[model samples]
Target: MSDLSATISPAVRLKGVSKTFGPIQALKPVNLDIAAGTIHALVGQNGAGKSTTLGILAGRISATTGDVEIGGARVDLGDPRRARAAGVVAIYQELTIVPALSAVANVFLGQPLSRGYLLSEGAMQSRFAELAGRLGVSIPTDAEARSLSVADQQTLEILRAIQANARIILFDEPTTALAQPEREALFKVMRDLRAEGHTLIYVSHNLDEVLGISDAITVFRNGSLIETRPTQAWTKAQLVTAMLGEEMGDIYHRRPASRLRDGEPAISVRDIALPGAIGEIGFSVRAGEILGVGGLVGSGRSSLLRALAGLEHRSSGQIEIAGREVAWPRTPRAARALGIALVPEDRKHQGLVLGMTAADNVTLPKLRAIARSGLIDNQLAAEVAADATRAFGFDPKRLFAPVGTLSGGNQQKVLLARWAFDRPKVLLVDEPTRGIDVGAKAEILDALRAFAEEGLAVIMVSSELEEICALADRVIVMSEGRQVDHIDASRAELSVHRILNSAFGVERHHHV
Candidate 1:
């Protein structure tokens, strides 16, 4: 089957293509071919140029050099209209469905049926039904897109592409918000598409999904293509190694301090529960300690943090601070009054105002401290934000820049720095190094360690197991909204394997 792919003409090919933004090379020159009727996956660490390559192919980005061919025809690489006309379509994580529009209207959004400027409603509905039937899926044509489930909405997007006669479809992290059954359904759809001869380019961080759905997998590292191999020829560990490159230990970052041990209890919770999200969760952490919550997606790790932050209204818990009983906080302001601060998972929507300057975002939590009687003292705010973030390796110059323009790493730095002004005793971080490059990951991890060094009890939730092992002094593994096991690093058994076993509700193995 692998050899057969080579003989069949490639549906898409890149020859010596590269991308650069200002002085930074986002993608190095690369030559590759994506065969027709195959699910090809592109995987790498964050900022490894997979998205850049996809942008060039989708005509959203102009390549700095080289040529792109779609079905043996050279393409004008930076025009979206040309890409669409050439049968190339990109389905992003953020769906393009208009909430108020009916399903059929969304499918034929800009290109509706018409007869001499008169709407042909019957024709549009029939085409919607036809496309849905051809995909072996069903979505009510008259129903509003907002009323549909996320899975159904995604299926609607695919139907839209199919309606446009898209021969090549690109999916970027399609299953990030999907449940197990929805993911399975989407996979079935992809398989069906392949069977009908549509080429797919799948980009994801989820190795399991990539392994299961792809015929071929390609690894990218530091703007370069590392390797491309059949899905059957790779293991998760091998994929990780390839993404990091051989002899690339220098990129790894983790240093848990010895002084973070044996501190007094800073925050203690008993029976924390969020309805439908997390079961009863209870734990304690010292003032200078970092405790990690490890779990699979939907295992209640994030819900636990949300409950602690007082974002979950139905969450009920008994909490104490500094060995003193404190009333359980019901709102975020109440949590702040209790000296608890949560740096939420969705930074764009929940954490920062993207249009605001980084300095403004950082000082937002404690405007009172930086403001005079009537108006804000801008100088004081800037000075405070600048001084407090140096230890985190954030630049003072970027503080004046709008947070939206900053890279993911810098935006995260701004988010973390916001907590400094208010100075919480307990800090909650969700996916601290998510969507950032290796250099920035190290800076973020170091900032976290710095926070611990400053005597703040930090509770972190990380999907990546290695991150848990690196920065966590202790780990509490959760599965299905309940704590399954606890492993302290002091016991010399807090490895990724033991934690993973506990997350899966298996017995922890003793390391030899």
Candidate 2:
């Protein structure tokens, strides 16, 4: 490892930096320095100042007060162009690839080679080849970006940064969507970059990945810089405690098995299949049970949830409610009529109406129930929303506030409360509490448990194995499109490793 304490000037520096929007000071004053040619990491829960600090450095958002320095010299990276000019580039979570463009064209997108105001395609291809060679990555030069894998697209972004002569690069959640092998490939590229004397700043919520790639880690919380330590000096447990002021285990607790029921399952399904998504699979859940589905990124976890919700028209399945067989639900309306509700994956797009108020969103499913004389009762709607969301710790006074104005935590609460407003028999949630802070996570999980205790059968899908191990009374692991392993926490101990092993490929199934 390079000498972190060496007296050389830092490649990036933020001195007394702070950012605010109106009355909200999103980031408090922070002083941070990233040493030259080292992998530095920034970690925090949602609303933490880590993202704000990155924004100031990236020139995406200006800092309210303070100075930024590059190479010991003050520089004005006030916008994307200026930041690029200063040799700073950011690869956001959302890949910037244009689907129709080829790999060669994407590398030279904004700043392309031109000879006397005429595009120089030959020169661009030559430069692209050189950068690809430097990075030791093999991607078809003329391949359409949309056809490439996520890892290949990221390599194209890296080539773009290198074309701009960027010596400092920021990666935002770089490996969240990558599978195990793909993640290792990206890590190798990052290590190569560090060896070539480039400075890298990585931001991620996955603590294990953070520890593996970072030379040093900095923790941020509630708009303040909490602490910074060398990688070896910090444990995963320590990092969690610093980030949330609580141990990792404290944020998650196993649901008590005693709250479950002994009678027949509230809902059971057989032969769930959706084209190339999920293979024929089946499971059952009692009235007071939470069954979690765990798998890797494309392991059909969300697909299964969608199939059950009647969102996939091409999907075929056999479903039974309280041991009564019924025809498969092929439409959302049909599913709802049968007492099955789905809280979709993209809460902003597929789930809630952002322009609507919280109370308005909550009563959306059964709006007619709140109507009288051909007019909706605003007072009744507000009262109903307040009562529904109170169980999830949402502020009742904000019921009239627009859903867009609420935090991620509150928005999730709205989605859950809205779907469960009329009390469905089975609630299918995709990535419950995703993008929510660690602080709000427990409350959301507990609320789901409380609902299960109320005799509501819940089927949850989460990519995070720790959540599956903690919140699910039973877990069914999926690999590719097939069921791999089944575990009953009530009968056996559950661990993240066991779930991951099955997800990676063990191919064992337990009948419904």
Task: Give per-residue CA lDDT, model 1, range 1-512, as digits (tens).
Answer: 12327589999988999988775688999888889999999988666789888888888889999999899999885777788999998998778999999999999887888888898999998888888887789888899999999999999889888888899999988986676778899999999999999999998877888999999998888789888888999997788778767523533355555484665589988888887877657788998888999988889988898888888888898998988998888899899998899887778788889999999998988888887996899999889999877766786767887887565667888888888767899999998876565556767787888788888999999876788788888888888888878888877878888887887767843211
Give the alpha carbon lDDT tens digit for every residue of 13-80 in model 2: 88888998666677998888889899999988766778777877788989888898899899987997
Clashing pairs in 2: 484-508
Q: Score every model by TM-score.
A: 0.75, 0.88
Instruction: Find the 10 residues in a row with the least total lDDT in model 2.
Output: 503-512
**lDDT for residue 453 in candidate 2, whole number 0-100:** 84
Alpha-carbon RMSD of each model: 5.5, 3.4
lDDT values of the candidates?
0.84, 0.84
lDDT (Cα, 0-100) at 435 in candidate 2: 61
Off by over 4 Å in 1: 1-6, 77-79, 113-130, 133-143, 226-238, 248-263, 270-282, 291-304, 310-318, 325-334, 355-414, 417-423, 433-454, 462-512
